[model samples]
Target: MYEYVRNPSLIHEGPLSKARLPVFLVHDGGGTAFSYHLLDRINRPLWGIENAKLQDGGWWDGGVPAMAAHYIELLGKVMPEGGDILLGGWSMGGLLSLEMAHQIALTAREAKNREGEAGDSGASTPKAPIFRVRGMIFIDSIFPLRLAELVGPLPEEPVFLSAEESRKMKLKDKVNLNMTHARMMVRFWQVPQWKDIPVPPTILMRAKEFVSRDSDENFVDYTRDLRLLGWDQYNEDHGHFIRDLWEVNGHHFSIFDIKYLDDVTRKVRKAADKLDPPDF
Candidate 1:
């Protein structure tokens, strides 16, 4: 599910390994990690967790919970002794990251029980994987539930689907699968269950514009709760504590453009550094 963007970068020699905290990023709507290549190298180990549909022909289990659960299993392959890690993504990817954190917290109890059993079995064995999310970075990400509510009606069927593809899918299957995954994402988060889940330290990067607005106006400039992108509506239980915001120059889809890469990288690196210091 995950692909490395930075492979134990040369910046980390043997002694500096202590500073290597991998950032496992979830994929955006494109269902692949291709766009993440645009990020300015922040020097930390980088990995992108891709959607299963991209390779498995849309037959994988659906919903954010299933995706989150599977991604956690995959994380074990790279960081088996799971400790602290930063979680982040763009747009829908960010929404999915939020679910991943909730799933991690939800399973912590079971993990603890299993960890006890492992400890009892052997004293010299490697620690069983039990990951902790240190913080989250949401790039122009709004809660899908809020979005679905705002967008009200979905089309009966997207006009893109063709008659022949319905009978025997070809390349259009990718487009069909993308819509399937999107619906699954919206459906899963539409229900309000993770409200009680603690909100971790978060860095929310809002684009200058979600859509064209009045001259000199940004989308957050009109939100009821300031710049949160309507997240305060569902995140009602846990008030913002470690949350920070960084405004980027561009629309939601175009914010990852190369021109803003350095600025974006700086804000993310600053947030990650605060979330997990070297001593941490």
Candidate 2:
């Protein structure tokens, strides 16, 4: 049923158990899910969504919405029926997760409306399974210009590989993967497209180190910017989907570094617990 996942190599399965919600993580701009290997110790079922663009070479045209739609379809097949799952991503993946959550919400609402209409008309319709996104976790994800403006400028250095490092690494495929996702990300932010969707409860894990020197000099902080963006607005308006900010040691890319793996895992575990308390 999950035909979209043509490349099984993309998914890294961790320990599975019915006692806890499975966490689905999207890859960063580079489109590699391996970066999240450090999180494997969380001891809950973990699945990483790889960059299908690399496998199918068809992601260039649709932008973020299309990407989200594709993943939503794949997720529906993989996730347990009526189970609330945790969705998240790092960097560009984080942005993708948010978009996916929005699309999921829209889908659920439409499904509910259809069921209501069917009942009113006395028509018997088979109900489709609903996919529930319990919460969202963004690891240094990007936002719209309205939010970016508050943080001032960010660093231009490549998060996955530096220019010199790319040459030394001699991994053209990886480089191309990064560029492809970066282009999509740029296209996504070209206009303020996302609007008026119910966002789920979210946790923003911020890297304490600045992305670049200028941000350090200017004292610009993305976490601070997120706060200014009125993250609490959703909670105030709907009494749900409250946003929480957490500061971790390292830069955007380094947060996944081995030295900080424990911290990252702990924070993710905490977020998961908050979203779905353990059955024990």
lDDT values for all models: 0.64, 0.65
- Runs in model 1 deviating more than 4 A are 1-17, 56-61, 113-128, 149-180, 190-197, 213-226, 278-280
Q: Which ten residues in a row have the lowest lDDT in candidate 1?
A: 6-15
Per-residue lDDT of 57-148 in model 1, one digit per residue for the tens? 33234566677777787777667667777888887678778878877876775677677887798644345577788888887776554454
lDDT of 2 by residue, 1-280 (tens): 2223442223434345445677888877677677776674565766788776644332445676777778876776674354567889887777778777777777788888888998899887765557778898878664544543443343443234455655565445664645455554554454313356556778877777766755532222444455523344534665455467787778776788989888888888787777777775
- Evaluate residue 219 in candidate 2 and report its C-alpha lDDT on the 0 to 100 scale: 28
lDDT of 1: 0.64
lDDT of candidate 1 at residue 187, scale 0 to 100:
56
After superposition, which runs of candidate 2 have C-alpha atoms over 4 Å from their true positions? 1-18, 56-58, 80-82, 126-128, 146-173, 180-186, 189-197, 214-242
